[model samples]
Target: MEVSYKEEVSVGALVILGLVAFTLGMFWLTGRSIVSKGIGVDVVFKDVSGLKEGDPVRVSGVTKGRVARVHLDKVGKVIVTIQVSSDVRPHADASAAVASADFLGAKYVAYNPGAKDEPLAQGTPIPGVAEEQFADIASRAASNASQLIENVNRGLNPGQLAADLHNTLVVTQRGMKALSEASNGPMVQQTTQTLKTVQNVMARIDSVLGTRDAAASGRRLDTLTANLGQLSAHLAAATKSLNELLTTMNKGEGTLGRMATDTMLYKNLNATLAALSSLLTDLKERPGRYLTVKVF
Candidate 1:
């Protein structure tokens, strides 16, 4: 069929539109922006964990751009070049990591803006962390479990354990049997008899001490206690009297107090005693003078 000019023009226009749409779709599918090259960021990781070019680049869990290139440096570190959206500017303190996008092992570059107040520097390299794959973790865990099982097998012998347990039980049973026999022996019986005899003697002693005698003894004790209490009171009174007498003497209030405290009175007493001694001596020397006996 010969196409009309208008139809031809329409087909051309449709083809052009389809091409443009396909280009845009591919860019979108590859997680790239059709606008500018966007901001470039270099991220270095120990290993990318399957991260590759065309992988989505996320900023704070949001898809922002796509990884443009991935290569290993001379130092064997994987460097990822990402072109993010114009608005995806991150500070110098930002962090980048290889993140798992799906269970099928699809990977992405996950970034954190980190401290929004920090200054953003262009083309600065961000340190990246390699994501731990679930399979690796599972493999390590399985290895550890295997090692533990092997160690248990090497250390533990079931036959030896069973034999040890049986020996222990047998020894314990024998000891218990010997103990039971000893508990029922002649010495045990003698001890029981001795205890019973002592109990009987104590009972007999209690019985021999009559209730009347006990009561009488308790009454006598009470009377003696009362007499002792009276004696104590009398002694206390005597002590008080003696203390008062001493206090009176110290104060020079009674005659003895004056004699004890007055120096002049003491001197006078001493002089009188000396004079009496002199008179007695003179009288002794002349017995007739002192002994004028009226024998008439």
Candidate 2:
């Protein structure tokens, strides 16, 4: 009976140990515990606030990893090292920001996995994101509220405000009365007459534009049409002559074509031009000896 009791106690102890081991294994597999098996990244924060070891690291509100360690560097800044799962690549653009989980000052590192092309390596430092503290926001709100209250106090003058409002109401009432008067009787009749005058002027202009005499008001248009027709015929003849000239030039038939294509014609033309220039110079110096002018 003593041996059976001892055996039962031993079995109970073994079962408890197995349960504990199973729980630990499950935690490790689910990445709940701080294990040094995965990729590590470092982040520097201005203030750790209430962040601690084994705190979950979230990416866009989803838990991806945990904070492995938090320590102060030589410069006295809080340097936090986080271990994330190897499956997720935290790129270089990934930022670390402190976020509160509850009112109990429980803070965690939140990450933004930005720009997929640049995957962060082991021991890489993530850039810190600017976090607005609740205290600072509350202080700013209080200051703004105080300023608004001061502005209201400065602007609130009951007597002057009442007088201004009364004056504005009186002016508005008078303006409404004037507008009502203008919309009725003789004023409306005058507006109608003006509109009718405008309509009549527009009708007259339309009639003038539609009239045959108005269409033929200027003789310059007829003259221009005749001149354009003659110019067009002359241009057509000139174009035909130009085409024939181009054809003759292409066949090297004219003097200009020979001058363009033949080197001998170019030399002869050059000599002739030089000789003509010299004869003109001599005739200008001694005009009567070069030629006698006879009027018959």
Candidate 3:
């Protein structure tokens, strides 16, 4: 049976619509399966750098899940919610980082499970981490390469440096040879003679010190010690005597001290001298007055 063009077009359109609906249903079912079987967790990154929804999530280089959504929070943080398999327990201390999968800038989420204890929970927000960007790493490497080139430019050639060291060694060797030639023979003989003279003098001293008369010298030293002891005792006795004499003088007890310190003795001595002088003058002027007993 021949159909109308309008009817045929309507049938074709319905088939296409059915295929589209079936594809949509399959996609919806897949999404629900992923959500139910996988655990969902939120991650915040400082810079996602080409990350998008449906990117694969990896744990230790193995693909575990995919990113569900990428959105900017109220605070302008790039929050990436990821769905991971429930069979794999991610640690609470696990970190989520954005990483490149290939050279074509295919980005993915990397989960580093730190320890077995304290597993991560669903709907928890992982803190944003500072990731090393490719541009920054390249810039630092360029700077380091430039500095290395500058260092290489400033370096000296190895051949020239070795030649300079060789020249220094040659000069040092020549100087040592000249010094040895100048000091080799006569100076060495003179030094040897001087050492021999010193040895001879030491030998003479040892011989003299080792003689039998050295024993007599020791005996003389003992005698000298005894004499010193006697002298010290005499000195001590003299000091005692001198102290007694000083005590007697201080008390005005001795005749010499009285003569030195007594005022009455001084006056009597002066009067006696005057009387003797007067008698001497009288005898000198009238000799018969003192010599009259000589006549018969």
Candidate number with greatest TM-score: 1
**Number of clashing pairs per prediction, in order:** 0, 0, 0
| 139 Cα displacement, candidate 3 (Å) | 1.9
Local lDDT at 36 for model 3: 48
lDDT, candidates in the order shown: 0.76, 0.71, 0.71
Per residue, candidate 1 scores C-alpha lDDT tens digits across 3-75 of 8999999999999999999999988887666665778888888889888778988887888888998998856
Give the TM-scores of the predictions, in the order they appear: 0.56, 0.44, 0.44
Instruction: Assess the local accuracy of residue 141 in candidate 3 as a C-alpha lDDT between 0 and 100.
Output: 100
- Judged by lDDT against the true structure, how good is candidate 1? 0.76
Tens-place lDDT digits, model 3, residues 1-296: 89999999999999999998888787575443333457778888777888888788888899888888889775558898888887655678878888888878888888765586987775678875645778889999999999998787668667778988986775455444433654544434545555565565556555555668967757655655565565556556556655765566456676534544565765697799999999999989999876866546
Ranking by lDDT: 1, 3, 2
The CA lDDT at 284 in model 3 is: 96
> TM-score of predicted model 1?
0.56
For candidate 2, list the clashing residue pairs, or say none: none
The reply for model 2, stretches above 4 Å from the true place, is 1-35, 74-76, 157-296
C-alpha lDDT of residue 24 in model 2: 94
Best by lDDT: 1
